[model samples]
Each structure stands twice: as C-alpha cells, then as structure tokens.
Target: MKRVDVAYVLLVDEHEENVLLVKNKGPGASYYTLPGGAVERGETLEEAAIREVKEETGLDVQLGGIFSVGEAFFEERGHHTIFFTFTGKIIGGEINISLPEEIEEVTWMNLQQAEPYIHISNEFEGAIDSKTTVPYMLRDAGRYRS
Candidate 1:
C-alpha cells in the first residue's frame, strides 16, 4: 500500500475559544478541517505544519509542541496515511484562502459553531469535543491524513 504523511496546525484565536479551519472545495465530500497539508519529501512535520497553514490560510504561524498523531486507511484510494497535529500561534497575515482551487474559505470557529461544518473523523473529533487537546491514534492504515 502507498504511504503518506501529513501535518496540521491547530491555531486558536486570541480568546482561545476558536480554532482556524479551512472549507475545502474539492471532489467527493467537502468539509471544514484544520489548516494543513501533505509533507513533501525532505520536509519535517513542523515544517509541513507551518507551510501548510500559510499555504491554505495565508497566515504565518509559529508551531508549538505536538498535540497528537493519527492514522487512517482508504480502501478505495489504496493508500495509507499518518497525521500529526501541533499547536500553532498565528504570528502574522490576515485570514485568506491562499489557494482558491482547493480551499473555499478560511475562518476561526468555536467548537459549537464548527461541529456542524466539520467532517467527523475518529482522530480529530475527540480533540474538538474536549476543546483543550488533540487525541493520538497512531495506527497503521491506508488513507489520507486529516
């Protein structure tokens, strides 16, 4: 099976009550998710996290400690993916959808406001419910990392 690694940044608003999320406009089911993307070759998890946040949201961020890790599998896609999420502090830039083709909107949302829009996954859903930390589900699988 194919293997992939992705990193996401969880950035909270100044009030610490909201998180930055992306509304994607891709094929299949579209949904709002944390700002992040795939880790390119030679890129570390932290580097990917920062880069993805900037690319997706047009916001510069300082990555903090790792909050959680998860894995998923996609039988239809025939791939395996590992996901790592880290805390992030927005250092600059306004909220913008850097890539219009892939991203529809970028916004900060509290858990209650986001629950309906977010696509539920075993890995990150718990993080949203708790509102304080991300959960780790590092198991083998074949899928895209969220």
Candidate 2:
C-alpha cells in the first residue's frame, strides 16, 4: 500500500507565550488544528509546509525542525498516512482565512489554552499538556524520501 505524506506547521509567538492555530472547516467548528495538508506532487516537504500555511492561513512561515510525528493506517481505504508536524515562525503576511472552504478562522492561544480546542488526534496528546513545550521540545531533522 502506498502512504500519503502530509505536513503541518506549529507557529508560536516570539514571546513563546502563544501558539497560532487554525480553526478547521467541517464538523465540530470549535475544533482547531495546525495549518497544513497533503504534500503535492513535485513539492518537497519543506516547500509543501510553507505553501500550505500560506494557503490556509494567509501567513508566510519559516519552517523549523520537525516537531512531532503521527501515523495512521486506513485499512478500509488501504492507505497509510504519515503526518509531519514542524515548528515554524510567522515571517510575513497577516491573519486571514485565505481558503475559507478549508479554514474557519485564525487565532492564537497558549499551549494550555489550546489543549481543549485541539482535537487533531491522539498522537498529539501531550503536545500542549507538556511543560517542556518549545525550546526544542520535540525538534529533530526531517528526512525526505523521493
């Protein structure tokens, strides 16, 4: 079975007090997630991360090291998905839902405050609950295979 590659960006405030999250469009309007999507053909992972953020959040980002990873297998669909969440910082543009069809709103909140709002997946369990967030908490180099 072929695997799908997806990229996600975690943008935090410079003061390290807040994290930028995008309110996803679709069921549970209250739920939030990072700005990202599946990698497009011919686009490198880093390029995809930057593009996804700009497309979904209307913000330019400078992606940092890999922050965390999540994997899921859809047996019914006969496909597997690997999620690569990366740390990033806003470098340009302002808050806006570039693609309202895919996003609802853009907002920022500290990790603790974001915990309840985020229901992305079980793999992201301790991301906000951990006291060791930021400062390279889960950062590592990302390897891209073509």
Candidate 3:
C-alpha cells in the first residue's frame, strides 16, 4: 500500500463556540469535515494545512501546533493515509468555497450541532466529540528532541 500524508485544521470562531467546516461537493457531499486535504510534494505538513484551508474554504489561517494524528487504510485503493490535525486562527480572507469541485459550502457550527456530520475513523474517534467540552481532538501525538 502507498502511504499518504494529509493535514487538517480546526478553526474556531472568535467566541470559540463555533468551528469551521466544509461540505464536500462529491459523493459524500452531505457530510462535513474540517478544512484540509492531501499534502503536496515537497510541502511541509504546516504548509499543506494552511493551503488546503485556503483552497477549500477560502480562508487565510495561521496554524498552531499539530494536535492529533490518525491513520486509515483503504484496502481497495491501497492507500494508507496518516492524518495530522492542527488548531488554527483566521488571520484574513473571507469565507468562500474557492474550489467548488472539491467543496460545496463552508460554514461555522457549534460543537453539538456539528457533531453528527463530522465523522472520523481509527485513532480519531474519541478526540473530536461535541458531547464533551473541548471541541478539537487535541492529542500529543509526537515529540521532538535535538
């Protein structure tokens, strides 16, 4: 199986009561997910997170540290994808679905209201539940030493 790296961002509004989500345009169009996508060749995980948010949601954001990591294996596609999720702040740019082919709409929803549409698999299951207080699935998935 081929390995793929993807980055996602959780952008909370000023009140911290709402989260930014994007509705995809294709088959799973009814579902909503955090703004993010596949990391491009030679792009850092941080760069990809920022870029995907901008491209998918038309929002310019500055990412905080990566908060969680999840893995998924697609047997049919032979893809083993590792997902890196980060917390981010909106620095500029307005909400718009720049990439219509990939995204249908972008909106903010409270944790409870957003819960049903947000689905996750594998290691991401517990971290992102609106039933609790914290919204983003924040976990210490790595450590660095020099």
Taken over the whole model, the C-alpha lDDT of each candidate is 0.77, 0.76, 0.77
- Per-residue C-alpha lDDT of model 3 across residues 1-146, encoded as one tens digit per residue: 99999898878787778889998866643668889989988677887899999898878998776656778899988999998878789999988877777777899999657655444544555455432322433344453333
Candidates' TM-scores?
Answer: 0.78, 0.75, 0.78
- Give the TM-score comparing model 1 with the true structure, all chains together: 0.78
- Flag clash pairs in model 2: none
TM-score of 3: 0.78
Q: For residues 56-125, what per-residue lDDT tens digits would candidate 2 score against the true structure?
A: 8889998777776678898987879998877888889987777877787888888777755444456657
TM-score of 2: 0.75
- List model 1 lDDT by residue over 23-140, tens digit each: 8886896788788889999666777888899899889998776666678897788879988878779999877776999998887788667654444464456565454554433343
Question: Candidate 1 — number of clashing residue pairs?
Answer: 6
Better of 1 and 2 by lDDT: 1
Tell me how many clashing residue pairs each candidate has: 6, 0, 0
